[model samples]
Target chain A: MDRSNAMPTVLHAPISPADIAPFKIGDVVYISGVLYTARDKAHDRMLADPHLPFSLQDACIYHSGPLIVKEGDTYRVVSAGPTTSARMNAQTPSIVKQGVTAIIGKGGMSQEVARSFAGRCMYLAFTGGCGMLAREKIVEVLDVYYAELGATEAVWKLKVLNFGPLLVAIDSRGDSIYETVRARSHERLLRLIAERKRAL
Target chain B: MPSHREAFILHVAQALQEAETRLPRDVTRALANAAKVESNDRAKEQICTILENVKLAGAAGLPMCQDTGVPIFFVEIGREANIDFGLKEALATAVQRATDAVPLRKHAVYPLTRRSCDEPLFDMICDVSEGNRLSVAVLVKGAGSENVSALAMLEPLQDVRPFVLNTIWESGGKPCPPIIVGLGIGSTFDGCARLAKRTLLRSLEEDQSPFEAEILEQINELGIGPMGLGGDTTALRVFVEEAPCHTAMLPVAVAVQCWADRKARFSIKL
Candidate 1:
């Protein structure tokens, strides 16, 4: 494990799937390296064919289909905000086990995925709709892996800066912010309804 | 005819861009009032900050919100109007330009591959009504609140209160607090969904139907509050739009618009 840059509050990792397994809840992580973008269709394809197009070992997967503009030889990311993570719930565990280090997306993931990948990979929630801000951190768009997927769904290798202001929602210990919030909200809602009924 | 087409397209585009640039007047006022009425200090402060940010963004010509949203256009075209240009194409072109010009965030996703690293702006839906005068309403829906939207078809005899309340409860803090609930009732499943989307475009300050007004009061009484932190103002407003439906089914669709509630409308004659 690389401890040279790890701080008590946040850890700096060359971030790979292997490195993600040991992270605990509330651990702030600054991922500064390459990550790939994929959303619905890409997930479907990867699922249909057990053989992934590229090696995902120790890599972070971002649930985003960024706006890009092509230059002479490279592509520039205009906005690369994270999409809702819940949409990818079914495919998460499978992708996580494929050696994904961390998952970056908005909203929350499904309970099954959270439980299955608990202690194996961490899920980080990014602020939704901050595409331009997210793009600012990208140093370069390394390469486009799947052109057929079009710009939004293609897997593009992105090199990032202090790339994230991510919240540690799901830790290696199986803790999930989504689950906690949902349970609490449900209880509060029932109480509110009950009170209203009593008053009626 | 061409002139009318040009006028319609240009006016609609300009209206949408201007709305995108400026904060909705009612929203600005409501947030201020909400801040004053809110008892929770933290939620009050949050509302104040959000209002301030909106003002600053508008003044500086920055996006009102980070999520400019997928540009959804609801157009009512007059049957007698002789428009030479293709309305859909014109709107699409305007959107593409706005995506770059207003520098609106591109929120459109390609259905397959989900690889939208480029060409971010895409049309989500467009509804056209034939008429003599064209009325276009543009609503820019952000992903945060949209992610929490829900729809359910109830038995004709079943009460809808439970379904609506449960959906709102499930939404929690994800949609951002103090949301506007757009309820579409009485249509087919898909029609109701579209009605729900269209309802968000209605002005918050306008007087609603009597039944809807009563429902709105009840919904706000839910106490979901700002950011779901718990307070008196769970929902800012509720708009219900209905269409005639079969007696056997009751389709209900709920679309939640966050505090941002970005929308604008314009009309043109050809």
Candidate 2:
């Protein structure tokens, strides 16, 4: 893996099916544009609501519960990093159906989520716990929805500029680096356990 | 003028702020070393970004991670110490102050209702020490790692290796590797968890026991890598804390901690 050969592919959001089709697992990406924050609570609430305050058409959803604070009339993002996407696995297929083209999160989503990305969606993984780095990329807090769910759980609409260095862990073609890694690890785990037992 | 208790509370708040904003030297050094050893490009990128985030967070005096995490305090009180004020109340007050001052995100909520709570959320563990000083160490634990921490009571004959490996396997990237695996072996169920959690407070620079070193080697062999994306480094270190347990029980607790490994400590004589 020559680090120099793999420069990050930067995609501006409102990303379309065409925009994401070429990305494959192991490719690096950087996103710049509108990103909405939605954690577990916000996902459930959004799906349950018939009339959403915003549209998901060609949107990029960030699986994050940022540490944001309000100073007078404006909201400040102190830190904003991706939360585990697997936790949102149950809701993601439906979210993709709603037209979310790119899901920016950390960790990996389920194989079902990979299936959901068959033609239109992709999962970009920002390094988990790099909130400060993420915050630095977020240029503005455009607006917020579901404020009633409290600071951490609410939906925050944000404008970001080159908010990445994210890895394409799952892609539109129904392939996933996570699944590959998981299968390999499980096999190793079984072998290790078997060897330990044999030594006994 | 502020009283001694007030001063102590202020000290705790500062420590919390310090822990939240900066990556401790041991943790930072470990991550840097891991980054150098990573063979996978994606894994290397993640580790580099994490190092950059740590630097930015410290420079700006902002939290290194958004989930400023639940503050768990390990308080060591000397036997000869005398406390005129309520230590628990002071600690709670310090948490609230730190929450506001460090601007810690409010993470407390009523469990069943899922409604946010006004009071600060924290946990404290106290133990007696030899001196007349009160030493408090705060471990800032994020939900990603904390959620995956597991406790199992295996039969006395059962092997501990499989349980630890399985826990890490199931956790995958959810706990955010390269992580720290703190193993507590041979204690009561609850005590095992405490023992495991406490191991995280130790400096990563400390020498690992032979058993700890063996488990760590096995874990990295799984190649879950950084963020489980298939790399050479899945976990940076594994710390084991063992205790005597019931004859029939072989309790094991795996306390997973993310790379952030945020923590700070302060000691005061009263």
Instruction: Report clashes for each candidate as comma-separated counts.
Output: 26, 0
Candidate number with greatest DockQ = 2
lDDT of 1 by residue, A1-200 (tens): 55338663333434654566666644555677777888877777766766666777777788887778676887766556677677788888888777776788766677788887756678886655445557667898988766676666678788887776565778766787667656765776577567656765
What is candidate 2's lDDT per residue for B108-190, written digit by digit as tens? 89999999999888999999989789899999899999999999989998889999999999999998899999999987989
Model 2 in CAPRI terms: which quality? high
Question: Model 1 off-target regions past 4 Å?
Answer: A1-13, A16-30, A45-55, A191-200, B15-70, B77-86, B96-133, B141-157, B170-179, B187-195, B205-236, B242-251, B258-260
TM-scores of the candidates are: 0.74, 0.98
Model 1's DockQ? 0.14
User: In candidate 2, which residue ranges exceed 4 Å CA deviation?
Assistant: A1-8, B1-3
Q: Quick one: how many clashes does candidate 1 have?
A: 26
lDDT per model vs. reference: 0.71, 0.92
